[model samples]
Target chain A: MQNKITIKNLNAWFGAKQVLHDIDIGIEKNGITAIIGPSGCGKSTFIRCLNRMHEVVPYAKASGKVLVDDRDIYDSDIDPVEIRRRIGMVFQKPNPFPTMSIRDNVVAGLKLGGLKDKKILDTMTEESLKKAALWDEVKNDLNKSGVSLSGGQQQRLCIARALAVEPEVILFDEPCSALDPISTSKIEDLMLELKEKYTIVIVTHNMQQAARVSDHTAFFLYGKLIEFGETDQIFKKPKEKSTEDYIIGRFG
Target chain B: MDRLKLSFFRSSRSKLSGDFIFEAVVGLFALGILILAFLLFRELFIESGLSRKTFGLSFLFTSTWDPVNEIFGALPFIFGTLVSSFLALLIAVPFSLGIAIYLSELAPEKLRTPLSFIIELLAAIPSVIIGLWGIFILAPFIRDYLAPPLSTYLGFLPLFQGPMYGLSMLTGGVILAIMVIPITSSVSREVIMTVPTHQREAALALGATGWETTRIAVLPYSRSGIFGAVILGFGRAIGETMAVTMVIGNSPRISESLFSPSYTMASVIANEFVEATSKLYVSSLIEIGFLLLVISVIINVAARILVWKLLKVEGGKVA
Candidate 1:
């Protein structure tokens, strides 16, 4: 499989405390890669580094090579804004822009980038919302505030917002953690559909979710990657003792 | 066992009585404020009864201020108060928002605390000292450097048409602006800071630049709050007496020129109340005081509503 993103010896720190140890992983193009780990295992930080978002926190720093499409994203000349545009992220909690209407929230990424053509914005909004499985539900209430929706709908709205920019890769930082089981299942199905076009990376604590939807799985523990392999192999015939123990609900 | 149960019941009853006393005491204090407000209004109303009866509604429309003849009108003072306060708002709003945005969004982490402290210090300075500064420094500066260029370039407008006297409406407006900036900016900074991190991150993830994120996410989210701050500033400006009185030239004449001398209601009352020997003269000044009080109450109520709306929206408890 062709790798869309390559990380080599990535290290991250928040103030004096280092969180992500030396790590190496590759995300495959047009595939969903699930990173499963216990709380505070640095799974979220790893993906944040891929899009140069780790440096946004005050006193937080990272040292690594994150190569996207064979170019180092952390190169001094590269713009983090542009890097972020190409790599979208949906947070654990659904955070649709509260001030914006449903339609405006979807087109916010494009509109804020100075896209003035209303026809294009309208088309893109419809297309992106349709892709996120939210168009039919929100089409009539395009003028309603984004936060007026249910938690699950709001997450889908955020996904639609991310897709509005037409990013090449999408990152999910526990996107379904705050959602109900039905919403979780819906998101998982949507991810399966989305992987056909965009590279997908998910950080999830739900092992069953990782086993159910991911083609490839990476198990992380104590700021280190313990195993990376096909989901079937990792679940059925695990090579690492720690991975097996974690998969079978042993000590996290 | 019976004794232990009786002791427990006695303690619980005492606690309930303590709670009732606490509620009644606090409730009385809250009602005390309302009663005090009512008493103040009644006093002003009774004290100004002579002027209310003599001038009736025409007092609002007429511009005459003949203390020698004891014939007073509120128009000039009303105009001065509104124009100067609005001018102060026009000057302060931009600076306040800029300061707030810079402090909350753009300033370095190390600078935030010191800058905030300095702004609060500005607020803490007494209005009389600011009035003194207006007399010594601000008025002369406006007369020499600021007024000449403004009149020469924008003189075609009526507001900039007159001679540049140092102590004039423009100076009063500038003084009020200086006095109001600290409160407006600090409140705005607080409102902007309340914008959640997730909102900013959401904008950043959408490829928004720093300014774009602030414009799209921060400003809109805090719109009502910033407006409430501005209104609060306006309330302060309209009621400002010392600094404005020192620089406003205290003339009871209306003019189209901002450079012309003016008198605000609060300033006029402060200047003339103690000196007035006649009952009617004192009553007229008290009438102006009553007007000022009414205007301030209206503005404060509006500000409270806007701020309350902001809280409701943020709390997500009301539609």
Candidate 2:
């Protein structure tokens, strides 16, 4: 299988405080890989580095190589804008552009890309909403403000916006952490379905969720990856004692 | 319960406690302002009684201002104020928006804060200094060079067809435009910054350029607040007295040309306030003041209503 991304010897920091320490991992194309860790274990930091989103925060720096399809993303000549174009991100909260209509929100990414054709935009809008499983609910009120939707619907709308750009990889930074159980399950199912067409990486605190959706699991602790393997192997028979302790809830 | 009762007894309650005294003082302060407003209205009514008796409501419509026989009308002043203020907004809004966008989005992190502070400081400079600078420097330059050329091409416009006087409504309006820019730009910058980070990020992630992201996301998100800021700046332009009075030539006759000297309600009041010898003259000026106060209040109320309506459109979550 072709590897979608390769992160090698990755070390990251926020000012003087180091976060990720020598992390090396390869994620396969069209696969769902879950990064499971306690809060502040640098899982979110690691994902943000993939698309250079972490650089938005002040005093943040990262070293080592992150490769997407053999291109070194951190190379001096490589543009962060291009990396983000290839790898889209969804945040923990549903942040739809409140000023835009539901239909406009779906086509926002395309419009931002400078695609102005009305017919093309219409097709993309419908297709993106369908892929996000929000077309049925929002189709009637397409002209209403995106903020008028329920929280769960708004999150799905954001997902549709990301999809509209036709990115190869989608990174979820604890996307459903702010949703109820039903919304969470729906998003989980959407992720599984999404992986058939696009590579998906998810950061989650719930081990059961990691086992349920991800084909592979990488467990991080104290800013270090303790174990990485098949989901069943990582959960049931983790070779590292720390990984086992974490998976069994003995300690975080 | 016994301990609480003992503590309560130990802390003696006076007739006028700190909270009551503080409330009383603030209450009296608020009442003082209300009383001042009432007195101002009463005085204006008394002073305007002559104009009401002589010119009647035509005082507002008549353009001829003859102070020789004490025949005073405010049509020209009102017209000048509205035209100049509107022209100032037309020039200042786009310029201020560009400054705000540059300060908020394009400027480097090292420069953003300092540049923003500088723009805000321009707003604090006394209007007299700006007026003086306009009178000596800007007015002469416009009259000698720019106005003559503009008139050569666009003189067909009634506003541009006139003698190139250094001090006229156009010169005053341009000066007022500079004055209003800092207020409009700073308020707009604050509003634009409040547009959620995610909106910009979302646009950027889709391969949008920085300019593209701002155009699609930042501008739309802050549209209502920006409108409100423009109205507030318009209010400042309308009420600005010292600088406008100096540059506007204090002409009270109505003219079709912006290059002609004209006077605004504010400039008229300020120019005549110290020189009024007659009770009726003072009262007319006071009535002008009353009109200005009412106009400012109306602008503020309209701005608030627009903000409320915009919020309602945005899911009714008031800022």
Candidate 3:
């Protein structure tokens, strides 16, 4: 399989404290790779580093090379705005702009990309919603305020919003931790289907979810990657003691 | 066989009485404000009865202010107050927004604290002291430098046609604009800062530029609060007395020129109230005071309603 993203010697810091230790990994194109770790294990920080979002936080810095399709994303000439466009992100909370309507929320990224044709926006809105598996329920109420939706629907809307931008890779930072079981399954199914077309990196606290949805699983502990392998191999016969211990419910 | 249960009135007698007394006391506190307002209006109306009877509604529309003949009208003061306050808002809004944006979004963390402290210090300077500075520093600067160049180029416009006087409506407005910046900027900064981090992230994640992110997310979220701040500033501006009196030249006439001397309601009352020799003159001044109070009350009520509706329309929850 061809790799879409390659990382080498990634180190991140929050002021004086280094949160992400030296790490190296490659993510395959058109597949789901899950990053599983306990809290404060730098899973979020690692994904944030891919889009240069970690550096946006005051006093936070990173020294690393993140390559998207053989082009180093961390190069001085590369703009973070362009990098973020190529790699979209979904936050943990279902944070739809409260002032915007459902239709407006879905097309927000497109508008930011400077797409203003009403007909195109209308078509894309429906298509993105369908891709996110939310069109059937929300098609009739497109004008409703985004915040008025249920939590599950809001998450789906955010997914649709991310899809509208047509990013090559999408990052999920615990996208379903706040969702119900039904909603979680729906998103999981959606992600599985999306992996056929777009590369996805999911940071999940749920180990079972990582095993169920991801083609590959990477285990992170104390800002270090302990093991990266096929999903079944990582879950069933992890090579590292820490990885096996984590998978089997030992100390996180 | 049926047993009768206690009626709500009889069963909850102690609770009902307790609620009644509690509500009455709370209602009395509410009624106290209403009574005080009513008393204030009644006294002002009675004290200004001479002007009201003699001039009727023409008192507002007429421009005459002859203390000797006791022919008093409030049009000049009203016009001056409206124009000066409007001009102040025009000058202050842009500068205030800039300060707010810089402090909340762009300023370095180390610089933000001291700069915010400086703005608070601006607010604490007494109005009389500001007036003193206006007379000594601001008026001369305007007369010597600003007015001549502005009049030379823009003299075709009636607003810039009149001869320059050191003390004029423009001087008062510029000083008022300075005084208002502190309140407007501080409130706007707080409002912008209250927008949730996720909102900013959401916009940035869409590949929007920093300015675009602020425009789409931060600004729309805090618009109502900013509007409330502007309204508060406007209210403060109209009610300002000593500083405006010092710089506005105490001229009681309708004038289009920024450089022309003019008067406002509060300034007029402050200038003439203590010096009035006749009952009619004093009554006219009280009428002016009543008019000022009424205008302020209307503004406050309108602002409250507008802000409430704005909050409903925007529906932005600050996290």
Candidate 4:
């Protein structure tokens, strides 16, 4: 598989304590890759590192190369905003812009990107909602507040919002963790559909979810990438004893 | 028999419920305060009714305030109140917003707490002290230099005309502006600080610079709260008595120029309350107090409505 993102010897620190230690991983292009680990194992931190969102916390710092499509994303010359535009992220909680309407939420990144044309905004909003499989539910009430939507619909709306920016890659930080079983199934199906057009990376605690949706799975333990391979191999026959132990629920 | 005795003892171990009584007491305290406010309003309205025959709403429109003829109109006071407060707001908003933005978004971790305390301390200074400072130092500098040049160029406008007097509406407004700045800035800083981290991350991740993120995401998200802060400042300006009474010159007559002596509803009441001997005169003064109260309530209500509408539109989340 072609590499869409490459992280080489990446280390992250919060204040004096380092969290991610000498991590190196490559994300596949236009494929759904899953990151699975026990709680507090740095799965979320790894994804945030991709979009440079981890830097928001005071005293949080990262070192080493995080290259997106061969360009160093962490370079001083590169703007984080532009990087984020190309690589969109959906958080664990359904965070659609509260004050904006459903229609407005979808096109938020574009609006922030300075796309003011009404026609273009409308077209992008429709296309993004369609891509996220949420167009039908929200089309009638485009003017309704984004928060007024159900939890599942709001999550999909957030996905649509990320998609609206036409990002090359999409990151989901345990997107289904807060959702119901039905919503989880729907999002899983949507992820499969999205794999054809965009690079998708997801962090999940559900072993069954990783088996269901991911082309490749990266198993992490204690801020280290322990094993990474085809999902079936990782689940059925893992190389490391730790990876096997984790998948079988023997010990995390 | 022993088991039965132990069970009874366990069942009776629950604590007494005094929480309900405590809650009732607090509720009664709140009710008492509300009742006091209502009674004050009612009394002011009743006394102010004495002047209604001579001064209708026309009192609000007419500038002539003649004490000898017992003919009192509020136009001049209204104009002075509105114009000076408006001027103060114009100066205060940008300055306060800047201060708030700096404190909330820009200040380093170590500096943030101290700087915030300093700004809040400004709010603690008594209005009389501020008035004294405006009179002794700021007024002379403004009259001799700032007002003369500004009046020369902008005097064509009614609000900035006439001779540059040391004691005028301009002086009062400038002093009021300083007094009000802390209220606006501190509240706005708090509002801005309350903006969710995800919103800031969302904007920054989009590649927006610090300034752009603050401008587009943080500011718009907190617009309603900032507006509430401004209304609060307005309330302070309208009801401010000692500082305004000292510097506004307390001329009851209407004047177009900022340099001219003027009076506000609050200042008028404060200046004349001691000397007002007649029952009708006292009632009229009380009426001015009534007007000020009504104006403040209207402003506060309007601000609440706007803020409610603003909050409902967006889930208080910035995209």
Best by lDDT: 1
Q: Is candidate 3 or candidate 4 better by lDDT?
A: 3
lDDT of 2 at A155: 86
lDDT of candidate 1 over A1-252, digit per residue (tens): 899999998999999999999999999999999999888899998888888888888888999889999999989999999999999999988888888999999999998788989899999989999999999998999999998899999999999999999999999999999999999999999999999999999999999999998989999998899999999999999999999999999977
> On residues B152-186, what C-alpha lDDT tens digit does candidate 4 reach at each position?
78878987777777898888888889988999999
lDDT of 4 by residue, A1-252 (tens): 799999999998889988888888889998889999999888888899999888878888999899998999999999777888889898888876666789987887787778999999999999999999999998899999888888889999989988988889999999998899999999999999998999999999999999999999999999889999999999999999999999999976
Q: 1 or 4, which is superior by TM-score?
A: 1
| CAPRI grade of model 3 | medium
The candidate scoring highest on DockQ is 1
lDDT digits (tens) for residues B198-272 of candidate 1 = 888999999999999999888989898899999999999999999899999999999999999999999999999
Worst 10 residues of 2 chain A by lDDT: A105-114
| Candidate 3 all-Cα RMSD | 5.3
lDDT of 4 at A88: 86
lDDT, candidate 4, at B104: 89
Where's the lowest-lDDT run of ten residues in candidate 1 chain A?
A47-56
Question: Model 4: how far is B131 from its true place, Å?
Answer: 0.5
In candidate 1, how many clashes are counted? 0
lDDT order, best first, reads 1, 3, 2, 4
Listed per model, the TM-scores of chain A against the true chain A are 0.99, 0.98, 0.99, 0.98
Error of 1 at B157 (Å): 0.5
